[model samples]
Target: MATGFYTHPDCVLHEMGEWHPECPARLQAIEDQLIAGRIDGLLERREAPLVAEADILRAHTAAHWDFLSANAPKSGYFAIDGDTVLNSHSLTAARRAAGAAVAATDAVLAGELENAFCSIRPPGHHATPGTAMGFCLLNNIAVAVRHALDVHGLQRVAIVDFDVHHGNGTEAAFAGESRVLMCSIFQHPFYPYSGTENPAPNMVNVPVPARTGGLEVREMIDLTWLPRLEEFKPQMIFISAGFDAHRDDDLGGLALTEADFSWITAQVKAVAQRHAHGRIVSCLEGGYNLSALGRSVVAHLRVLADL
Candidate 1:
C-alpha cells in the first residue's frame, strides 16, 4: 500500500497576519521541497473534505463549536487569545485541517493506504475540548483518533506526539482512558506549562529541558514510550508530527534536526509495523522555519513512504 497525503488548498486561505509565523506559505514550502526532491510520485494525494459536525462533536463540546461559529469574523480577525485568532476563512481552514486527519484515518483503516500524512494546518495539538488555543481551532489528531476508535471499532490506539510543546489538549482528552495510550516529549517550562504537574498512568509524558538533543530524546522515548506501546499493542498509531524542535526553528529551543525527525518517524513506524500491521496516521502540528519545516516533513514522509 502507498502513503496517502491529505491536504486542501483552502488550508492556505486562513492566516493570522502577514507577520505571524503560521502562514499559508508553510504548505507551499512542503510542496516546493517535494517537487524539488522529485518525490511526488511516492505519494497518493487526497483532497481534504469538510469534517462532519458529528465528528467535531466527538472530540469537542458543542459549546466550543458554537463559540467558533458565533465569533468567526465576517471581515477581519477575531482574537481568541493574545495569539490565537480567527478570520472569515479560519474556520473553513480548521475544518479542512481536521478533515484531512479524519480522511487519512479512514483511508488507512480501510487499507486504501498503508499509512498517511495530513499536511493541513491551523496546527492542532493545543486545542482542548472546549477551548481553542495556540492557533488551533480544532483538535485534528483527537478528532481522527476518536473516529478510528468509535467508527472503525478500534479498541486500542496509540498517539505519539513529537511536537516541541506539550500536547496538553491531547492529554486533556485521553488522560484517564485506557483504550488510548499517549506518549509525548516536549521542552520543559515551555509554552502551556503542562504535561508535568501530574499525568495519568496511561500517559508517558517526558519533559526535557531546553536545548535537549535528538540522542537524549531518543533514549527517553526508548526508556519511557516504547515499553508502554509494546504492552498496549495498539491496533493503530497516530503521530502529532511537529518539526519546530529543529535547530533552525526560532520558535523552539530544542536542538533536533531533520535527522532527528526522521529517527522519530522511523521509531514510530517500527512500532506500527510490529503491532498495527503498519497502520499509522500522521498529522502536521508545528515547525515555523519554512526551510526546516519542508525538509523535516520530507524526511518524515520518506520513512513513511519508504521511498
Candidate 2:
C-alpha cells in the first residue's frame, strides 16, 4: 500500500492573523512545493474527518475540550495566549487537525497503508492536556496516540519530536503514561522552556545548543534516542515533524537542512521497521521559512513515502 496523506479544508480556515508565522501560508507553501515537484502522485490523499469529542477527550480533559469549543469566535479572532489565537473556524479546524492524525493512525495500524502523514494545522505538539499554548490548540499527535492505544489496543507507541522548540505540551500530556515513549531534540533556552529540566521517566528530552546542526542532531539520535527506542520496542511510531529548526527559519537557532530531515526520517524508519512493522504516523508541528519548510517537507515525505 502507498503512504497515506491526511488533511482537511477546515485546517486552512483556522487562521490566527495576517502576521502570525503559523498562518495559512505554511500549508500553501507545502502544497506549492508538492505540486511543483509533482510529489502528490506518490501517495494516497484523503480529506480528514472532523474528530469526535471522544477522540479529543482521550488525550485532553473534558474541560479543555469544552473551553476550546465554547470560546471559538463567531467572526473575529480570540487570543488563546499572547501568540495562539482562535478564529471562527478554530474549533472545526482543531477537530480536523486532530482527525487527520486519527485517520493516519487508523490507516497505518490497519495495514491499509504502510505509513501516513497529517498535513493539517494548528500545529499540535505544544497543546497540553488542559492548556493550549505555543500556537497549538489540540495536541493532535497525542490524540492519535491515545486512539491507537485505547481503540486499537496497541501495547507500545513511540513519539519523536524534532522541532526546534521543546514539545512541552506533548510531554505534559504523556508525562506518566508508560505506554508511550517520547523522545525529542530541541534547542535549549527557547520558548516555553521546560524540557531541559527534569521530565518524566518516559521522556528522553535531549536539549541541544543554539546553531547546532545536523551532526549534533545525528549524534543525539544515535547516542540517545535510538537506544531508548530500541529498548522500548514500540509497536508504532508517531513523529512531530517540525521544520522550524531549519537554518533559514527564525523560530530558533538550530541549523538543520533538508538533507538532515531526510536523514532523521530514515533513522526513525529503521527503528519502526525493527519494532513496529513499519507503522508510522507523522504530523506537522512547526516550520516558518517558506522555502526551507517546503524543501524540508519534500525530503521528509519522500523518505516517509519510501520514494
Candidate 3:
C-alpha cells in the first residue's frame, strides 16, 4: 500500500498575521516542492475531515474547548498566548489540522496505508490539555494517540518528536501514562523550558545543545531513543516532524540539514517495520526558513513515500 498524504483546505485559511513564520506560505512551499519533485505519484492523497468533538475531547478538556471556542474572534485576530494567536478561521483550521492526524492514524493502522503524513497547521505538540500555547490550539498527535488506544484498542504507542523546541504539551498529556512512550530530542534552555527537569518514567527527553548538528542527532537516536523504543515494542509510531532544526533555519540555532531529516525518517521507518508492521503517522510541527523547510519536508516525505 502507498503512504497517505493527509491535508485540508482550511489549514491554508488560518493565519496568525502577515509576519508570522507559521504563515500559510509554509504550506504553499511544501506543495510547490512536492509538485516539482513529482512526489504525487508515490503517495495516496486524501482530504482531511473535521475531527469529531468526541475525538477532540480525548485530548482536551471540555472547559478548555469552551474557552477557545468562546474567545475566537469573529472579525480579527486574538492572542491566545504571547506566541499563539487566533484569527477568524483559526477554529476551523485547528479542527481540520487535528482531523488530518486522526485520518492518518486510521489509515496507517487499518492497513489502508503503509504509512501516512499530515501536512497541516498550526503545528501541534505544543498545546496541553488545558492550555494552548506555542502557536498550537490543539494537541493533534495527542488526540491521535488517544484515538488509537481508546477507539482502536491499541495497547502501546510511541511518539517520536524531533522538533527544535521541546514538545512540552505532548509530554504534559501523557506524562504518567504507561501505554504511551514518547522519545524526543529538542534544543535545551529554549522556549517552554520544562523538559530538562524530571521527566515521566516513559518519557525519554534528550535535550541537545544548540549547534549540535546532525551527528549528535544520529547518535542520540542510535544510542538513546532507538533502544528504548525497540524495548517498548510499541504497536504504532507517531512522529512530530519538525524542520526548524535545519542548519539554515535560525529559529532554534540547531545545525541539522535535509540529509539529517532523511536519516531520521529512515530510522523511524525501520523501527516501525520491526515493531509495528510498518505503521507510522507523521505530522508537521515547525520549520521557519522557507527554502530549508521545503527541502527538509521533501527529504522526510521521500522516506515516508518510499521514493
- Give the root-mean-square deviation of each candidate in angstroms: 0.7, 0.8, 0.8
Could you give candidate 3's per-residue lDDT for residues 223-305 as a string of tens digits?
99989999999999999998999999878889999999999999989999998999999999999888888888889989987
lDDT of each: 0.93, 0.92, 0.91
Off by over 4 Å in 2: none
Best by lDDT: 1
Q: How accurate is candidate 2 locally (lDDT)?
A: 0.92
Residue 254, model 3, lDDT: 92
Task: Give each model a TM-score.
Answer: 0.99, 0.98, 0.99
lDDT of 1: 0.93
Q: What clash pairs does model 2 have?
A: none
Residue 116 in model 3: shift from native, Å?
0.4
> How big is the positional error of residue 134 in model 3, measured in Å on the Cα after superposition?
0.5
List residue ranges in candidate 3 displaced over 4 A.
none
* 1 against 2, candidate with superior lDDT: 1
lDDT of candidate 2 over 139-256, digit per residue (tens): 9999999999999998889999999989998898888799999999999888878897778999999998898999888988999999999999999999999999999999889999
